[model samples]
Target chain A: MKISIKRQYFIEQLNHCLKAISPRTTLPILNGIKIDVSDDQMILTGSDSEISIEITIPAEIDNEEILEIEEPGSVVLTGRFFVDIIKKLSGDFVDLETTENFQTKITAGKSEFNLSGNDSNQYPLLPEVNDADSLVLSSAVLKTIINQTNFAVSLSETRPVLTGVNWNFNKDNISFTATDSHRLALRRLLDKTFNTEISNAIIPGKSLSELSKILTDSDEDVEINLSQNQVLFTYGNMRFISRLLEGNYPDTSRLFPENYETKVSVNNSEFYHAIDRVSLLAREGGNNVIRMTVENNNVELTSNSPEVGTVNEAVNASAIEGEDIKISFNSKYMMEALRAIQDEEVTIEFFGTMRPFTITPSESSEVVQLILPIRTY
Target chain B: MKISIKRQYFIEQLNHCLKAISPRTTLPILNGIKIDVSDDQMILTGSDSEISIEITIPAEIDNEEILEIEEPGSVVLTGRFFVDIIKKLSGDFVDLETTENFQTKITAGKSEFNLSGNDSNQYPLLPEVNDADSLVLSSAVLKTIINQTNFAVSLSETRPVLTGVNWNFNKDNISFTATDSHRLALRRLLDKTFNTEISNAIIPGKSLSELSKILTDSDEDVEINLSQNQVLFTYGNMRFISRLLEGNYPDTSRLFPENYETKVSVNNSEFYHAIDRVSLLAREGGNNVIRMTVENNNVELTSNSPEVGTVNEAVNASAIEGEDIKISFNSKYMMEALRAIQDEEVTIEFFGTMRPFTITPSESSEVVQLILPIRTY
Candidate 1:
């Protein structure tokens, strides 16, 4: 392949595909990025066996010439080396040509690099998923769903299914749930209709995390195609394909408590800061447990490291009604849950001292968060 | 101690002292910052045995009230905990008071923390350095000297003296030199008169690294007092004390070549970028050696990793007048020396292949940098 392209634009596309080329890939070929150049555009692909990302750079964009192809060809170059050279080049445009034996020569300004590339035919092909069972949603909504639930997924691989976020779709809505058994986070979108053949699937939390990073906060529609073993996400000129986790996800639908004896409405920042201070002392010890007491419309947090010190902070709450109660839970888990809510105020409901409590945004109950209380008594 | 101080101002001083509190400190008391309250000012000190930092907050400064001292007392609080609390407090002012059993009450806004405090008397005392042999320097000059020489200090403690920068005082200049045996970076201030008792001393690289961070970019004069075992730096109500490295620093005054067969003048940035690109290939393996060929007034750089590829670039030079030379050297060392010089153009003097070379600013020879060449067939 012989082509000269805008260095800056090419670097951006390279980064998106390079995300899938993990350093820990077992397959040596996966560490290289496959670049296929046709008459119309150039496609860059990277994969780690679990997730594959492909980005396209067309010949001309917005009437501005982006790429000029002298000869159409293909080559797989080492991901990090090519990326570094492209970014550090001072020239406005970079020229790439594949010589005999798949040797690629890259030239920009006075710097030229001749890299030994593998034959593109040796690279593994991304799983093909037809647009059959496809569901479309706005990028913002999809990113929100990923952010709110992905953090709560299990980090352990002992239960492979728990390492993913469980997705269930109905005729009118879709809900995402993730839990590490110690805590659960749930987010649901009721407006969009998810009409497709697939009703449920467990997507790895890591895959969704990477997807969220690349998703722009625009109203652009992202089409998701699901197959038996793979799920494909396509938006703009980029395609992301991830392998679905096998095995049955835990039934956490009944994990949230139904009744509560106490309810408190607290400002996110105020409560967050209070808990952050109290956790300072709690973190001094092995167990990050902090006690919280809600009474007289005020929430008080207390934690102490016997050898270090103690911390007591009073958090202002808008409303605290019903029976006053004191409970203890892991401060870190609760802090992560509160940050994910992204709301000014949240309503926290407690069933009892030993039972799990739920926190939801005060304006909407679409996002539900639950944290099991620690037996501190 | 009982005092109420502006939280923002206090946090700034706390950060300066916290630099001395290392997590690897063997003495537990060293991890705590000692706060001493007097009628006129409050002093905060942190030490990890190797270095100590002290900052003072007066009751009034520049017609602004910074601290209100109610009583005179002393106590030591854990460094990280206290610093974290001060930074996160939303209140304009923080009130600190030591109560029974040395438990300190820290109140800021609605957040209060009761922390266990160690007796201030238990903390190690900072070494006293009188102003007998003193040197005064502008903060900018001091910071520049530290930055230019510190990066070249030996990180390995095998030759403990090499881990520090050797400062030799001349009648009208002070020369700072550091070498890890592979490469040497030397910077000399020829204008400053040395009117002190001490002729030379070695300061630890770590101490200078921390001191460089806290120095501001102003022309404010800084007082440096040198003692037998300690060096104290006083500037803007802050005192930084570092232990001196004992033992004879190696004599390398003759390392610079007196005669060179080749002399080349090159732009700093041009040569820097070329070496950086070439290193990308050499770094693929363990050795970071890159070849340079200077002939016909152009410096060509080439490097290759057998498994990766080869990179070649021509660096623009203003002049290359001397015998043609082919030399190999570590690109990382060259890049670092170039960055530390802070010069637009430098004149390079090469003795020959496998011989050490010297680089100095084309404008002047105040800052001399040396790099040893590697022998390659």
Candidate 2:
């Protein structure tokens, strides 16, 4: 491949492409990024068996020439070194040329690099997905959905299905849920609709987390195509494909309690800070458990480590209803849930001292976080 | 201690004091910070056997009351936990009271902490240093001296003396030098004299690094007292004591080359960036060595990893003198020396292809960095 491209533009595309190249890939070819040059555009592809990212840079963009292709060819270059070289080259434009022997020469300003390249044909082919069954959602909305629930996914591999976020689409409403048995996070979007039949998919939380990072924050729609075992996301000039976990996700709809014995509404920041301080002592105590007691208009949080110290903090709640209750739970889980609320005020509903409790944003009911109390007799 | 102090003001003092507490101290008491409160002021002290820091927060400063002493007492609290609690407390003022049996109560806003404290009498006393023989230097100057030479110190404990920065005050000049036997960094200040006899001391680079962080950037003089085995630095309302490295530091004055076969002047940034990029290949090669060849006004830098690739960069020098020469050296050492120069234009003097070279600012002679060339076939 022979091409001349803007350094800044090339660096941006390379960053997105490198995300798919995993550091511990067993296949040596997966450690390299494949670049294909043609008369109309250049396509860069990076993959690590499970996820692949391909981006296209057109010959001209926004009435400005972005690339000039002298010859059409292909080569695979080591991803890490290629990215670092392009970033540090001191020039406005970079020229890349591949020889018949698969040797690539990269030149920018007065700096020149010659790297041994692998045959592009050796790279794995991207999985093809039929577009007949597809769903569309804005990149911004998709990113928010992933961020709100991905953290609650199980980090252990004992139950592989729980390590993924379960997505269910019905009629015009879509819901995303993730659970680790101890806690659960669910987010629902009411306005999104699918043109195809109802669909359900379990996407690895790690994959969704990586996808969220590469997706733009713009309102442009991202077209997603689903197959029997893989999913494809197409946005702008980039295509991201990830494999779906092969298993049935446990039903979590029954995890949310239908009734509450106590409810407390408190300012998010005030309550968050109080728990954060108490967690310091809790963390030292090995279990990271803190007790929360509500009475009238006051909520008291307490944690202690015999060797370190004990902390007691009281934050005023906006309102309290139902019976007063005392509950003990892992402070870390509560803190993570509170951070994901993204609201000024949050309402927490408790069923008793041992049952799971749910926290919801005071302004919206689309997001819910549920936590199981720890027994600390 | 029984005292009501502003949280911000108290946190600042606590941070400075905690710097001396080491996490892996054999003596448990050394891991705690001692708080001694008197009618006039409250002193916070932390020690790790190698270094000790004592900071005093006066009851009043600049005609403004910063602390109110309700009762006079002393207690030693766990350093890490104490700092964390104070930082997270949401209050303008914090009240600390020592109860019977050494239990301490800390109250701020609606947050209260009860910590088991040790008897202050168990803490080691600060070493008494005679002020009869002392040297004074501005904190800014000391900080600059540490920054310029500390990076060159040996990180390995094979040679204990080389792990410290050697300070020699003689006549009307003071010189600080550090070397790991591969490269040497020396900084000299002229026209600065001391009131006592000339002295030589080797201060551990790690201790100097911590001292530099706690020292103010102002030009206020920092009184340094030299004892047989320890050094004391007093500034404002703080006293810092550090144990001196007991060994003879190798004299580095003879290491600087007296003559040169080649001299090159180049823009500091240009040279630095080129070396940084070329080093990527050198690092992958396992030796991290790069070669530089200079003739006339052109300089070429090249590095290669047989399995990875090769990079060659050419930069134009402002001027080149004497015979043409080619030298290979560790790129990391060269990059660090160039960064320490802090000058727009730098002059590099080379003795031969294998001898050591010196880098210094084009306009000043106060600082010099000498690097030993690596032999590359």
Candidate 3:
């Protein structure tokens, strides 16, 4: 197999695929990137067992010659070293040729590197998904949905299902939910079209992270097809696939409270800063608990560690309703929830001292974050 | 103690002093910064036994108000927490007040933080150095000298002296040398005004690394005073004192030979890239040794792992003389020394197959790097 491609354009696509390749794969060939060249396009594939990314470069882009295929073939090369060499190679065009003995030669300008290649047949094949069960959503919405909820997923392997974010789709809406038992994050987007109704799946948090980076923020829509064991997201010429966790996700809809005795609205930045300062002192303590006292027009946040000292800060609030109450919760969870709010002002609701509370944007009911209160004296 | 200072300016000085403060200190007072407010200036000090830094903020700079001293007093505050709070404070001017009970109030904008302060008498005093044995050099030259030789120091604690760089000053020139015993780097500068003949002293590589970041590449001169146990550098209203490592430094002047059997000249960038590529394969093999063979005008660089096959590439040399020879050395050491040369083209002088060779810029003899050859079959 022999091919010559533009260095810059080829390097860009290789970088995206490299994100899916893991350095600690037990199978030696799984640590490589598989390359397939055909008469019309060139395909690059990188995967670990959990996630796989494949990108194709077409024959023509803006009437420029990108790839010239002398022969159609496939080969797998070391992903880490090959990417470094290509990025640092000083030339406009790079030439790749593979011999029948599985020896590959790479040349650009005056520099040439030869590396041993593995048989492409050794690489795992991607599972096929039916197009009829595909769903369509804008890239911007997809990235936001992942970033907002993925961080709340549990990282421990003991509870494997909790390590993945639960995705549920209806006729025209998509909902994402994640929880570590201590805190929960949920986001919903309406107007997304889905071919199937009321389907639920648990996708690993790690795969969503890699997918978030590859998705563009443009208005272009991305196509997603789901199967019983795998999910595939196709954007332009790139195909991203991930293995789904085999378990039923816990019901998170009941975790958020339906009503609250007290609610307070405050500037998002001011409230975030107040919690940030209190966290410095609480972080030194064992439980990372910070207390909030709400009054008529002022909210006071305080935390103390007997060994270190205490911090007391108060910020003006937009409005306070019902009975004034004091609530204590994890400072880190509140900070993360406040940071995810897109609006300038946020409204926080409290049911009781021990029950889970809810925080949402002032005008939007689309995103809600819940944190279980920590009992403190 | 009572004072009001511009928040940004105070934070900058605090940031500089933070370099000397280590997170974990056996003596509790050493982890705190000493703040002294006098009638004329405000001083901040941070020390960790091996190194100490003191920065003074005068009452006025260019007829501008920088510090307002309301009362004269001194106190020590925890370095780690103080620096963080000052950096995140939201105010243009910060008000600092110390109570009789030793609790200090730091007020900025609408936020207030109260931290417990310690007695200033508990902090260690800075060492004294005589002005009679002082030398002056521009910050740029001092910084350059440190950068070129610091990378060659040994990181192992087995040989304490080898972990520091040796500085030698004679009647007309000053020189710096560092080596981990495998390779050595030496840089010399001729300054006739620096006539004091001082003995060699080894300064810790870690101290020099911190000083390099504080010193700017400007024409401003910094004063260096050498005493029996310590070295002091004063510049821009700041004094930096570092304890010198005690031991006799190894004599490396005898490492370089007066003559050579072969000499070759090559472009700096081109040679660097060739060695970089060859090292990729060599690193996988045990010692990262790359062999070079010179036959008249053609020079070939090769490396073989036996299991991973072999790579041979020819690089163009502008000049080659004497007999044909093949030698092997660690590619990493060769590349580092080549990068330190301050010329477009460098000349390498080889004494024999087992002896160490020297690489120097063709245009000047101010800097030289020597690497010992490895035994390869």
Candidate 4:
């Protein structure tokens, strides 16, 4: 394949593809990025078994010639070197061509790099998804949902399904849920046009996180298609496909508490800072257990390390209803949950002392964060 | 002891002192910062045996009350935790008070922290430097000289003196030299006023690096004092004391070659970029060796990895005299030397294929960089 493209734009696209390239040594060929030069566009593809990303640079963009194609062919070049070379090349445009013995020559300005290439055929092909069954969502909403719920996914391999965030699409709404058994996060988009319905599509948390980073906050639409074992997300000129987790997702609807023994509403920033300061001492212990006592309308947070000292902080509580209670929990889990909550004030609902508590935006029920209290009796 | 200070300025000073406090577990009291509040000024000091930093905050600066010392006393607080607490505290000013048993209480806004404190008397005292015999130089010049030569210091402890940069303060000029046997960097400041002469004061590279970071580029003067086995650097309200390496520094004046067989001058930026590109491929091997061939005023740079391919690049030469030569050296060393030369054009002199060559700014001889060529044949 022979193609010349703008160095800056190509570098950006190559960086996107690099998000899917893993440095794992299991597969030697997977370390290279597959490049295809078509008659009208040049495509770059990268994969790491579980996730694959492909980006296309058309010959012309916005009436400007972005790429010039000489011959339509395909080759795979080492991902890291190719990227570094392009980024450091001193020119406005970069030329890439393949030679005999799968050798690729890249030139820009007065610099030339000859890199050994792997056979494109040896690279794994992205899983094909049927586009007929797909749902469209705004990129902003998709990014927000991913950032909010993806963090709670279990990072262990014991339960594979728990390592993914479950996406359930119904006729009227779409719901996203992630839980690591100790904590859970659920976000819902109440009304959006959906062409299909999915009961259980467990998307890997890593994939969602990467996709969220790639998807800049925009009003543009992103079409998501789900197959039996693969899901494809197409936005702009890029396609991101991820292998779905193979297992059944547990029903967590019952885990969220409906009736609570105590509920408190506090300013988000004040409470987050208070807990953060207290956690500095709590973090000395691996469990990071910090206690919150709410009596009347006063909320006191305290944590102590055995050898180090203690920290006691009080945050303003705007509303305190039902019975007052004292609860202990992992400070890190609560901080993570609070960071995902996008609101000025948050209301936390506690079910007695040992049961889990839920923190949600005080204005709406669209987002819910639940954390199990540490039994530090 | 009781005091109230602005958290912002306090944090900045604490960070400077933190540089001296290493978590090496050699001395338990070294992990804490000793704070002493006199009648009008508050002093913070941290030491890790080898290096000690002391910062002073006056009761009033520029007609602004930065500190309010209710009483005069001293206490030692955990360096890391104290800094972290002050950074996260929610208030403009933080109140600190010490009670019996050396227990310290820190309060800001509604947050209160009681931390275990070490006895201030146990903190190691900084080495005393005779301020009468000292030289003063601009902070900017000191920073520049440190940055130019500090990188060449040997990181290995095989020879203790080699791990420190030798500073020779002569009557006419001040010279800074550092070498790791493979490469050497020397920077000289001509026509500087000197109070005394220093023949062999080897300041540790780690200490220089930390001191360089603390000294910002400014016209403010920095006082340098060298005593028996310690060097004191005083600037503004901060006094940085670093223990001198207790060994004789080798005479490296003979290392600079003269009457070169080949001489070449090239654009510094272009040549540096070429070597950087070639090094990308060369770095695959640990040595990072790249070859430079100069013929008919044309410079060609190339590097190859056994399994990977090669990189070839050319940089424009402004002047080429003497005999044409082929030399190979570590690209990283050459690149680092090039970075220290602040001139747009650089001159390189080569004696032979395997001899140590010199790279100096074409405009001035204030800075000189020498690197030993790798023997490929």
Candidate 5:
């Protein structure tokens, strides 16, 4: 296979594909990026066992010959070093050619790099998915969904199922939920007649994170396809396939308390900053717990470490209802929830001591964050 | 200690002094910052065993009251938590008052932090240095001297002396040299004079690195005092004291080859990038060794990794002198040395196989880098 492409364009696409490449893989060929030159375009694929990413570079772009396909063939080359060499090559265009013995030659200006390549036949083929059942969503909505709920996924390997984001979709809406038991974050988006019914699937949180990163600064619509054990996301000229986690997600609807004796509406920034300051003392405490006491029209966040002393922060807001109750919870969980809240004002609903409370923006009660309070007298 | 100070001013000063506070210090007191309040001003000091930094916030800056002192006393508070709390506090002015029992109160806006403070007597006092043996040099020159030689200092604690930068001062010039045996970097500055005879002192590389970072963005002259076992640096109401490394610095004068059989002059950026590209392949081989073959006016950098293949880069140069030669050296050392060279053109002088080579700016020989060649047939 032989091809010549514009350096900037090739590097940009290579960077996105490189994220899916594994630095270490049990199968040696899995560490390589497979390149195929066809009649009209060239495709680059990089994968680990969990996810695979592929990008296609068209043969001609804007009347310029970006990729000149001399022969129709394929080869798999080292992912990391090949990407680095291409990026550092000081030329406007780069030429890549592979010999019959799987030796790949890369040339740009006065620099030339020859890398040993594996036979393309040895590289595992990505599962083929037919375009039968697919869902389309704008990249912005998809990104927001991931960012709002991805942080709550459990990082523990002991409960592998909880390490993935669970996506549930019905005829009219899509909901994403992730929880580590300590905290649960849920986000839902409305759509016009989603083709699939109430189907639930879990995508590894790490794979979605990489996919979100590669979709940055793009406003195009993304197409998603779910299969028996694999989910495919296609956007622009890139295709991302991730293995689905095979397990049942814990039902979190019953965990969020519906009744609240006290509800406080506070400015998001003000509350976030106050908790941020109080967390300084909370961090010194053995348990990073910060207590929020709502009395009359005032809200106070306090943290105490006997050895280091204590911190008290009072923020004035519009009215507090019911009993003047106090609840202590992890400051980190609250901070993360506040940061993810996009509304100017957030409404926090408290149930009782030692129960999970809900934090949701007043504008829309659809997205909810539940934090389990710690009991302390 | 009771004082009310502008939050921004206090935070800025704390940021400087906080550089010397190491959270990993074994001594508990060393992890705290000592605050001394006087009727006229307030001083903040933080120190680990190796280095100490102190900054003074005057009562008034340009007739505007920045600090209002209610009492004159001293106390020590935990450095890490205090710095973080003050930075995140939401107020323009911060009120700090110490109770008779030594508890400290910090108030800013609606947030208040109460931290147990230690008696100032528990804090170690920095060694006093006289101004009689002091010299003044622009922060720019001092920073340049540190950057040019500090990277060569050995990071391994095995050799106590090689882990520091040796400063040699004469009546009219000062020279700084650092070496880890594998490579040596020497920088000299003229027009800087000392009242006494040549004074030699070795300051820990880590301390110099911290000092250099503080000197960044400052162009004013800094007064430096040399004592028996410590060096005092004073600038803009800030004093930095570093414990000097005690041992004889190796004599690096004879290490540089006086005359060379081969010399090559190339654009610094060109040569650096070529080596950088070749090193990508060389790094995979083992210790990142790249070979340069110089003949006449051209130089080719090549790296071969049997399993990964090879890379060849040709860099343009002005001229080459003497016998044709091929030499191999660690790419990292060459990259660091080239990065420190100030001139656009760099000249490398070589002796023969397995010998050390000197790299210097083509225009000036004051700054030199010597790298030992690696024997690879």
Candidate 6:
């Protein structure tokens, strides 16, 4: 394979391709990136079994020559070293050529690098997804959805299903939910453009997190194709494929209480900072638990460790209704929930001190976060 | 102890004090910051065995009240946690009060933190250095001298004396030298104002590095006091004390070659970037060795790995003097030396192909760096 490509463009695509390559891959071939050159464009692919990323650089972009192809062929080069070399190469254009024996020579300006390449034919084939079950959404929307809920997914592998973010599409509404038993984050969006009803897919939280980083926040549409065992995301001359987790996700809709024994509305930033400070002392006592008591228009948060001392903070609540309640919960969970609320004010609904409480943005009902209170005697 | 201080000023002083507190100290009291409240000012001190920092906040600075002292006493509080609490506290003024029993109460706005503190009497006393043997220099000059030579200090502790930078003061001239045997860096400055003839002291490179961070690059005078076992640096209401190494530092002055068979002048930045790129391939071959051959006005640098192929690049030298020669060395050392040269053009002098070579700034004689050539066939 022979091609001349702009250094900046190559570096940008290589960065995206690197996200799919894991250093701990047992298969040595998976540690390398496959390069395929055609008459008009060059495609780079990197994978580590769970996810694969393919980026295409056309011969010309926006009437400017970004890549010039001389021969059509394929080869696989070590991903980490190649990316590092490309990033540090001090030249405007890089020339890459591969011989029949898979020896690749990369040259740019006065510097040239020759690296041994593996046969591309030995690389795993990308799983195919049916186009009929595809949906298109704005990249910005997808990124927001992932960022809003992915953090709440279970970090432990004890329950495999909880390690992923469950996505359900019905009619024109798409809902994303993630939970780690202690807390849950849910985000929903309605798009009339997606006419096809697709089945629910459990995408590993880690995969969505990586995909979000590669997807720029733009108005461009990203086409997502779903199948029984695989899902594909195509956007901006790139394809990201991830394996779907095969398990039934638990129903979390009933987790939110219909009625609240007490409700308090407070400034999100003030509440977050207050909990953050109290958590410093709470963290020393183990479990990072902080207690909050609401009465009238004032809410007091306090935590103490016999060894490290205590912290007490009071934040003014806009309004409080029903019976005043005192609840003890994980400060980290509350802080994360408060940070995810984009609105200036958040309304927290509590059902006594033992049940899970729901926190929602005051301005929009599209996002909801629930935290189970820690029983502290 | 009781005082009310501006949050920003308190934070700045705490930061300097935090540097002296190491997390892995054997003595528990050393992990805390000592706070001594006087009638007119508040002094904060933190220390590990190697270094101690004391910062004083006057009752008034520039006619503005920076600290208000209601009582005079002393206490020691955990450094890391106290700093964290102060950083997150959201108030213009922080009020700290310590009882006779050493229970401290820190309050700001509506938040309050009560922390258990240790008696100041339990903290180790800082070593006192005599001002009679002191010399003063601008903070900027001291900072520059440290930065120019500290990187060459031996990182390994096998030779403890080489781990510190030797400061030699003679005839109103101060010279700092550091070497790890493989390479040496020397920075010299002539201070006519210092008339005293003081003995040389070997200051730990790590301590100097920390002191440099706390010293702002300004024209303010930093008074350095020398003692038998410790050195004190006083600048901007702060006093930093560092223990001195007892052993004699090896003499590295004679290591500089008196005459050279080959010399080359090249653009500092260009040479650095070229070596940086070539180092990528050299690194894969194990010792990160790269070779340079100069003849006439052309200089070629090349490095090869039997398994990764080879990279060769030619850089235009401004001048090449004496006999043509080939030399091989660690690319990292060469790159670091080139980076340390502040001048636009750098001149490298070689003494034979296997001996040590020197890289110096083309326009300044105050700094010199010597790198030993690697014997590669």
All DockQ scores: 0.80, 0.82, 0.47, 0.85, 0.87, 0.77
Over 4 Å off, model 5 = none
Candidate 4 lDDT for residue B168: 80
Give the residue spans of candidate 4 off by over 4 A.
A193-197, B193-198
Q: How far is A338's C-alpha from truth in model 6 (Å)?
A: 1.4
The candidate 3 chain B region of ten consecutive residues with least summed lDDT is: B190-199
| Per-model tally of clashing residue pairs | 0, 0, 0, 0, 0, 0
Model 3 CA deviation exceeding 4 Å by range: B307-309
Q: Write the per-residue lDDT of candidate 3 for residues A45-131, one digit (tens) a residue.
A: 999978999999987798999988887888998898788778867678899999867788888766667778889998999877766
All predictions: root-mean-square deviation over Cα?
Answer: 1.2, 1.8, 1.7, 1.3, 1.7, 1.9
Candidate 1's TM-score reads 0.98
Q: Report how far off residue A6 is in candidate 2 (Å).
A: 1.3
Q: RMSD, model 1, all Cα superposed? A: 1.2
lDDT of 3 by residue, B87-126 (tens): 7778788888999766888887667777788899888888
Whole-model Cα lDDT per candidate?
0.90, 0.90, 0.86, 0.90, 0.88, 0.89
How good is the docking of model 1, by CAPRI class? high
- lDDT of candidate 4? 0.90
iRMSD of prediction 2: 1.1
Interface RMSD of 1: 1.1
Residue pairs with backbone overlap in model 2: none
lDDT for position B263 in model 4 = 91
By DockQ, the best candidate is 5
TM-score to true structure, per model: 0.98, 0.97, 0.97, 0.98, 0.97, 0.97
User: Residue-wise lDDT of candidate 1 within A202-267, one digit each (tens)?
Assistant: 999999999999999999999999888889999999999999988887777778777679999999
Selected candidate, larger DockQ, 2 vs 6? 2
Q: Whole-model lDDT, candidate 3?
A: 0.86
Tens digits of per-residue lDDT, candidate 1, B1-377, equal 79899999898899889999999999989989999998899999999999999998889989999999898899999998789888877879999999988899999888888888999989887888887767899999899999999999999999999999998988888899999999999998888766777788899999999999999889998999988788999999999999999999888987777879999999999889888888988898568999999877678999988778888998888988889999999999999999988889999899989789988999988888899999988
Local accuracy of candidate 6 as per-residue lDDT tens digits, A112-177: 787889999999998887878568888998988898899999999999999999988766678889
TM-score of 4: 0.98
What lDDT tens digits, residue by residue, belong to model 6 across residues B202-236?
Answer: 99999999999987789999999888889999998
